[model samples]
Target: MVDTDSVTGTAKELAGKVRGAVGDLIGSDRDSVEGRARQVQGTAERAYGEGKDALRETADRVADAGADARDNAGRYYARAEESVRNAADEAYHFAEDAYDDGGRYLSEGRRAIAQQVEESPLAALLIAGAVGLGIGLLINTRR
Candidate 1:
């Protein structure tokens, strides 16, 4: 839409042209100069109006860009948050699985040790005594 000033300026310019033409027909120097001056004023007002329109358009574009950027940032933040939560859930499941595996392995190892000790009680007792002696010697050395 054309600015109000632009429309007004156009009307003024048309009037100025008519006035200037009449002055020329009547040979009036003062009217001729006045008409020319009015034309200049009209041109200037039109330019000012056009400039204001351009500035308003530019501001609107900038505002749209800002809103778009904000929306994009919000979407990115939401995606990032979802990714972190997913990773945390994966880690929790992985840790739970590892704990379960460790407990199963520990139970199997205990059962194996019990079986071995039962099969050779004397040998297990001898090995335990040797380990205790070695630990005692190590403690004395450290002290």
Candidate 2:
């Protein structure tokens, strides 16, 4: 990236040198002093331009670094969101399986109870009465 200020300053500096040489050859003190001043001004201008270019380069690098950090953070956020979604899905599946197993266990227990009742009606009736009495006693105790 060429700086226009630097190029202009360089051109001005060269012109000043030529002007100073001509003044010296012709014995003109005013022209020589003016030429030297112009040279100093040109040097200052070139330095200012160089400094500006350096600052611009630094700013560009900082901007690029910020963009990279933002992109990385976005990727990390997406990965975290996916991980959370996967965990939620796994938890839901686990709960569903447990619920199905619980239902199956309840149905099997009812079937076994029915079978026992069919095999021994008198025994089942006595057991039912005992269970009812036990429940009644527990309820009265709480009251």
Candidate 3:
């Protein structure tokens, strides 16, 4: 594509140069000046087009590199998120096991307390009455 444009621009420049030479040979000053101006304009335009093409190619390469970097970052972020989720799941299971063990310990303590209470009914009754009397006194004091 670039080669084609270069060749076409070169052809146009050659044609303008030929036209200017012919005008000079024929002694037409106006035609000679106009043809020369056309040749110069064509040369400047070709150079500008080549510069623009170079800038566009550079911009495309930069954009492609940016896209690749973004894709790599996304992949790394996904892996990091998965790692965090797995860690959280393991922590949750550990907490659940600890809670279950605590519940079992509390149940055993309650059973031991019940056995002690059954072996001393008279002591339990006296303790309950004392607690009730203390609550009544507290309520009366509040009033």
Candidate 4:
């Protein structure tokens, strides 16, 4: 409509102008008035068609922008999900390592205590009695 209709309307206007000029040259008042009316009508129709075409183009651009924004949002959401999963995996591995280290430390502490007790049975027995007395006192206070 923008291209074809505009061109047709322009052609009509030009033709009307030429006819009006010719009528004026020949002194035909009726033909001159008719030609001037055609020129005015053609101009109005051309403007209307051009306005419609401009509105259509604007609507298309807006739709395309909306689609592009939606696509970008989807990609960003996927990236955020992947990042969360990766962080969780890293945290799990870290916790596993810490648990293994704690187990090793506990084993070493038990062995050390056993060796000390073997080297000094009497001293270990006295220490154990003292620890038991301290625990009994704490329990009595809570009660």
For lDDT, the strongest prediction is 1
| Candidate 1 per-residue lDDT over residues 31-117, each given as its tens digit | 655565566556655655665565555555566678876566556555654554565455445545554665677689889999999
Q: Better model by TM-score, 3 or 4?
A: 4
Per-model TM values vs. the true structure: 0.51, 0.51, 0.46, 0.49
For residue 41, model 4's alpha carbon misses the true position, in angstroms, by 76
- Once superposed on the true structure, which residue ranges of model 2 sit more than 4 Å away at CA? 1-65, 141-143
The lDDT of model 3 is 0.62
In the range 1-143, model 2's lDDT, one tens digit per residue, is 75776787677778778777887899765566556556655655555556556655555555667887656655655565455456545544554555466567768988999999999999999999999999999999999
**Location of the lowest summed lDDT over 10 successive residues in candidate 1:** 83-92
lDDT of each: 0.67, 0.67, 0.62, 0.64
- Evaluate residue 37 in candidate 1 and report its C-alpha lDDT on the 0 to 100 scale: 55
- Candidate 4 per-residue C-alpha lDDT over 1-143 given as tens digits, one digit per residue, 9 for 90 to 100: 36565666677678768877886889765456556655554554454445445545555555567887656655654565455446545544554555466567768988999999999999999999999999999999999
Superposition TM-score, candidate 1 onto the true structure: 0.51
Candidate 2, residue 142: how far the Cα is off, in Å: 5.0
Clashes of 4: 0
